[model samples]
Target: MAIPRVKHFEITLTDEGVAIIAFNRPAHRNALNGEVYKEWDRSLMWAAQSPEVKVTILTGKGKLYMGGHQLASTADIDESKSRKAVKESIVCVQSLLNTLINFPKLLIAAVNGPAIGIGMTTLALCDVVYAVPDAIFLTPFMQFGFCAEGCSSYTFPSRIIPPDNFISDVVAIATKTTNFPPIAIFQTKNLVRARERETLMAVNRNECEVLLER
Candidate 1:
């Protein structure tokens, strides 16, 4: 299947039916912006709908996994545009969170390096996470005067695999997972996530509201 093209993310579908989505903006340490969120939503939807994609892996290019939201994008917001920008950001974030909350495929995260802010929070949404020993996970939301926006409050205490070869190891696991029967994979994930789906939706909505108020 042809994966959707994205400017901010590099997406590839392996023959094993794993869709690898990497944050490609290494020049900025893989920090996310409105554009990145939009592209992510689109890419994830494509993978979810593609029969060829049985699982999806999220990772980052270069050294850092993700630097979180691009604070620099808001640095230039003027008094007149501040409200509008904030509203737009809230919408984009809410949409992205909703996508992750409802995604049916097996989701894996390869934390190659530091995962800050949303980077850290989003790992809770993935089914599996593999991190390098030196990789840092921090959510300085209070320091930044922002609340969590990725259902981290409800999804905390997430697990992670400390692996030596992060990317290759993650891909190997994903490949093995993809070899399972497709219906079994989908139904098992659906049953496991059924109980938390509504709760996650509520958390995502509450988080976005709180973020907007902040």
Candidate 2:
């Protein structure tokens, strides 16, 4: 029997004109390794240049949002290889981020579970995010023995969770074991509004429709 090839993601345009991009690797907690990153970069660039997609909703397949990068996949990689992999991952993620940020359509994360590491950092770039009540948001750069990527170093502290002594807060949270509730982070300074997952989905749908109508 031949081994089957898996698609890293699937894209579908809803009747309401929302482009749904599902990260489809539930078994590995949707770990986005190299192939997934390449596919994501290509797909987002395609979508950004296309006129058909009016909005993009990014979600993970199955229960959890994403477990972040595939740590297990790198078990055999040496330090040099690991560095190269991280660099490539950053390029791919940054490419998609820059494209999405500049794209004409709205970008939203339909976060359903723990959005860890890159999963958490990616939301820093999303225009809207619908996080589940139990959503676990973590940035384990230092913990994971890696520096921050995804332009998160610049964006996360300055904009996403701006607070009193914001730079201090940024330094305080930039570590391995720290996990912060999105709402608690929001309340610290009141720069963002994180709604219930259901409410956010509704708001996403409504906002998409409103944008389409305009």
Candidate 3:
């Protein structure tokens, strides 16, 4: 059967308890944009709530996985709205990261291509990540003149290292993870990451405030 495809992403039902959310913006190299986020939010909710979904494999169409924030034309910032705009934007990213981190099911990221800025951070949120040999991972926050989102401030310090083998390894572990009882998996995730919540919260707030100033 042909797999189901969403306008902004693809959802492929695997053997029981696993799904793949593949980004669909080949032309833009799957850059993160408002519309993509809207769809992503809904898709994520579906995967999280659906009874049969216990694992989500996140990847992108074409070679590149995610190109980070979409490039936008520069606009003269009105003093009145600049802070509001920055805060609102940062809020969206923060909320998404929070959702991903707290999601009950396991998430595996496949970096088929370069993962820049928010893309790199998003990978860190995944329970497992598989990267192609040529994949480049970078956080370009300094160049973008904004603080990092997706809590890379903390995630990178720990998760983004060791550079595991490719998609095959991810598949192996994902398959194993799906076999565990959901309650045990969820509780273990909580127990392991519980201490990081406080740090993550502080960083989220600090990053937003700094973004407004930048």
Best by lDDT: 1
Kindly indicate the candidate among 1 and 3 with the higher lDDT: 1
Best by TM-score: 1
Once fitted onto the true fold, the runs of candidate 1 whose alpha carbons sit more than 4 angstroms away are 73-75, 157-164
TM-score of each: 0.93, 0.64, 0.82
Cα TM-score of candidate 1: 0.93
List, residue by residue over 1-214, the lDDT tens digit for candidate 3. Answer: 2343458798876676677788888888888765577677667878888887888888777778888888556586575675565556666766676677667677788777788878888776677777776788888887877767777777652224233454445556677778889998888878877877678777767776676677
Give the distance in Å from residue 123's predicted Cα in candidate 3 to where it truly belongs: 2.0
lDDT of 3 at 49: 84
Arrange candidates by TM-score, descending: 1, 3, 2
- Writing each residue's lDDT as its tens digit, candidate 2 over 1-214 gives 1112338886775444456677888888888877787777666666555655555677776777788888754558787777677566555655555554444445667776778877887786676666555667888878766666554554541234322343233233332112434345335323332333334334334433332332
Question: What are the lDDT scores of the predictions, listed in order?
Answer: 0.86, 0.59, 0.73
lDDT for residue 56 in candidate 2, whole number 0-100 = 64
